[model samples]
Target: MRDLRARFRAAYGASGWHLLLLVGCFAVAAWVALRLAGEATAGRMLLWFVGAVVAHDLVLFPMYAAADWALRTAVRERRARPASGPSLLNHLRVPALAAALLFLVYLPGILRQGRETYLAATGQDQQPFLARWLLASGALFLASGIRYAFRRWRARRG
Candidate 1:
């Protein structure tokens, strides 16, 4: 059994489950595509998809890549010379990512882009989105900071 498993792994370059999961994901994507194709708004959806890809590739990717590089450089410079403990990069990255994702998802509401539609759909004003997003971002950063401080304290105690 071990030999057969080893042979399978060697041939596949990963566990059989990986291939199964990959196929499953592709099947789900295909299902979504078929469903989208049946919709009257398929052209709009396709346009949005292409626009998102182009925006991410041409604008967002470069901006974030530069920001990440700058952040790493800044963190590396500020950190202790001996890289003995956990790095602060990931702690910063996680909160930033969460905040950015929240901002993006709530962007229309935050910007008050479609006040009438939003009001009609949810019967709520878009006035709170910006404040809520800010509060959430602050909470995420505060939580990350607390966790980092706790880890550092524990490391020092040990």
Candidate 2:
């Protein structure tokens, strides 16, 4: 049994279950792509996908990579001792990433860039998006700060 398991791992680069799940995901994606290809808007969807890939690779990737490098440099300077466990970087990163993702997902609404179309489609106003995004971002940061403070307090107590 042990030899069989090792052989499977060596052959697949992972456990059988992981490979099964990956193949299942690919199958679903292929099915969805086939369905979409039969639609009239397939070309438009493909164009948008290519645009998104280009935009992310050419624009967003560099911007975020630079931001991460700057953040790491600044944080490295501030820490007195080497990180022995999970670093403080992740504590800052998680909330920032979450907020950024939320902003991106609602970019049109947040900027009111699609107000007329959004209103026409949903019969709702996009007026609250900016404020709501700001509030959510603020809350994310506030929670991260509180968690950091609590961790620091615990460390000091210990």
Candidate 3:
């Protein structure tokens, strides 16, 4: 118990300063981004940022939370009833919503028709755009998983 506590304290101390530095940098960046926006013009960029924050907090977060809660509660109720398990859409919620969020977040890049345009330009069907995007995300997930596994393995070895 003492050894575990010591290790935890060591890790915390090592991380604390780095986390504080990161947060300070992030605050400065955000301030600079907002401040750097147009002072001569109508300040459209700041307005966009404010709108995005409100939309994300008021609309997106609540919608996703309600959807997840509803699906979970329905699943629980279905377990009790045994007749109604889950709606088809409910079953698809997490994946579909995740994909939508992914696609939406990269809306500009997606619409700029990056790899999709290149594929079409090369006489390939645009259908592969979806596959390509998924492949890219899958690779990212794989990388993250590998990194996490490596970290855990190292921590255990230490």
Candidate 4:
């Protein structure tokens, strides 16, 4: 395995050829997937892929990044307390991202020709993913609440 890896590294030299090969592999894989799942299904996959990429770049990442940066910056400051209060809003970094990503995955189908892949993956004719997203959001909030409650209880008991 090591010898083969070393030979491959020497030959490929990590260049455009490698990227071309990767794209070729993906093309073959996509073809196979379309064959197995049907061309209609493959077309849907393309739409979902585009929607997911757009959302991950535009929406979900920005929220998570901003919250993470804000938290880190708050900690770095010499101020006795962060200017932002220690409130539920300040700690919603993970939940907000989850909610946003969930929403984005569902949004591509809104008032437009819905992506087949999104519908297939979500198992709903319309807006089924939203129900699941809501359930997940509720779960995230419940878990957060339980953790906070437990910590408070522990502090009181001790």
Candidate 5:
């Protein structure tokens, strides 16, 4: 059994489960493509996909990569001792990523771009989106800060 597993891993470059999961994901993607093929909006979806890929590759990727580099550098420079675990960089990163995802998901509502259409459809105002997003982001940061501080306190006590 060990020899068989080793030979399979050597040939596949990962465990059998990894190959199974990869095949499953590809199957789902193929299903989605087949379903979308009959849709009239497929062309528009394709155009949007291409645009999103271009935007992420050309703009967002660089911006975030540079920002991460700067943050990592700043944290490393100020640290007098090597981090034991859960570096400050990661604590800051988690909140920032969560906030960014929230902002991206609610961009239209937050920016009030389709205020009239949104109001007509949901019978609700878009006025609260920006404030709610800000508050949620602030809460996330605050919680992360509290958790980091607690960890540091426990580490010091130990």
Candidate 6:
């Protein structure tokens, strides 16, 4: 069993389950592409897809990479103990990423750009979006800070 597993892993560069999941994802993507190809809006969809790829590669990736590099440099400069169990970088990163994603998802609402159309469609005002987003972001950061403090306390205690 071990030999067979090793052979499969050697051939696939991953375990059987991982390979299966990869193939499943590919199959779903192919299905979605085929369906999209048959649609009248395929060209527009393709344009959006290409634009997203280009925007992420050319804009978002570099921006985030630079931010992360700067953050790491600052953290490294301030570190007093070399024996810390884990860095606080990820703790900050996870919440910031979540908040950023939420902001992106609700950008039009947060900016109050679609007020008339939103009111017409939903019969509700878009006035709360900015406040809600701010509150959510603040809560997320607070939770992340508490979690980091707890982890640091446990690390020091143990």
**Considering only N, C-alpha and C atoms within 3 Å, which residue pairs clash in candidate 5?**
none
Q: How accurate is candidate 1 locally (lDDT)?
A: 0.86
lDDT score of residue 144 within candidate 3: 53
Clashing pairs in 4: none
Predicted structure 6, TM vs. truth: 0.64
Candidate 4 local distance difference test against the native = 0.65
The candidate that wins on TM-score is 5
Score candidate 3 by TM-score against the native: 0.37
The digit string of per-residue lDDT tens for model 3 on 80-158 reads: 3334333333334545565667777766455555666666677664454566668766665565556645655665576
Better candidate number, 2 or 4, judged by TM-score: 2
Measured on C-alpha atoms, candidate 2 has an lDDT of: 0.83
- The model with the greater lDDT, 1 or 4, is 1
Candidate 2 residue lDDT tens string, 1-158: 99999999999899989999999999998898899998999999989988999999998899888877777777874452334433577677778889989988989888889778888999998889899999999999899888877877777677
Candidate 5 C-alpha lDDT tens digits along 1-158 = 99999999999899999999999999998898899999999888888988999989998899888987887877874442435644588888889889988998889988999878888999998888899999999999999989988988887788
Error of 1 at 14 (Å): 24
lDDT of 1 by residue, 1-158 (tens): 98998899999999989999999999998898898898999989889988999999998899888988888887875462335555588788889989988988889988889888888999988898899999999999999989988878887888
User: For residues 70-135, could you state the per-residue lDDT of candidate 6 as single tens digits?
Assistant: 877767643523466555777777788899889888899899886788889999988888999999
In model 3, the runs with Cα more than 4 Å from the true position are 1-38, 73-94, 111-158
Top candidate by lDDT: 5
* lDDT values for all models: 0.86, 0.83, 0.64, 0.65, 0.86, 0.85
> How does each model score on TM-score?
0.66, 0.65, 0.37, 0.39, 0.67, 0.64
Model 5 CA deviation exceeding 4 Å by range: 1-47, 77-81
